[model samples]
Target: MSTFFHIHHDGDAHGPEAQRIHTELIEPVMRDLEERGRLDRFYVLNFSGPRPFVRLIVEPRESHGSNLAREVLASLRSRARELDFLGEHDIQPQGKVA
Candidate 1:
């Protein structure tokens, strides 16, 4: 299974704010997970369609399962909330289900 973070962006705000979040918030955590062999891949993508934003996808290692992935994703979501990237909500769960 995979974990996905759907990030909301404010175009009016400076671009680096989002960039900083990726560099400072997301990357290190992802790298740590990767180092532990928990994460297979993680990426942030920007789309040009309606309501532009970045999506973070975490694919777990072959030895890792969806439960662990969800736990890590949950931690990331909480961190995003703490960082004010998400309000009370805004971090949505998407894609294929169990």
Candidate 2:
């Protein structure tokens, strides 16, 4: 099984706080996961019109699964929460892909 973390950015995505989180929290974990072959995929989506928002999709390798990814994601979320940039987040189970 795979695991996906859905992150929603409530504030300005390009703002200083967001940048800090990206640089210090997100990017480092991403690099570590990539080097370990534990990163399945990552994507960013934007919603248009009023209340524009951005969404982050992160999938971790099936072998490592949610157990491992959750720890890293939780850290990232904690930082974001402290910065007040996080809207919400959720983890969903992803079936293995061929």
Best by lDDT: 1
Error of 2 at 22 (Å): 1.7
Candidate 2, poorest ten consecutive residues by summed lDDT: 89-98
TM-score for all predictions? 0.71, 0.51
RMSD values for the candidates in order, in angstroms, are 2.9, 5.2
Question: Candidate 1 lDDT, tens digit per residue, 4-98?
Answer: 76666565223775676577667877888888888888778764445556677788877776565566656667777676665535455566434
**Scored by CA lDDT, what does every candidate get?**
0.66, 0.55
Q: Which candidate is the best by TM-score?
A: 1
Off by over 4 Å in 1: 12-14, 96-98
Candidate 1 collision pairs:
none
lDDT by residue for model 2 (1-98), tens: 43444444444656654455456656766777778887777665444433434444566787776466565556666666665655434222233322
Whole-model lDDT, candidate 2? 0.55
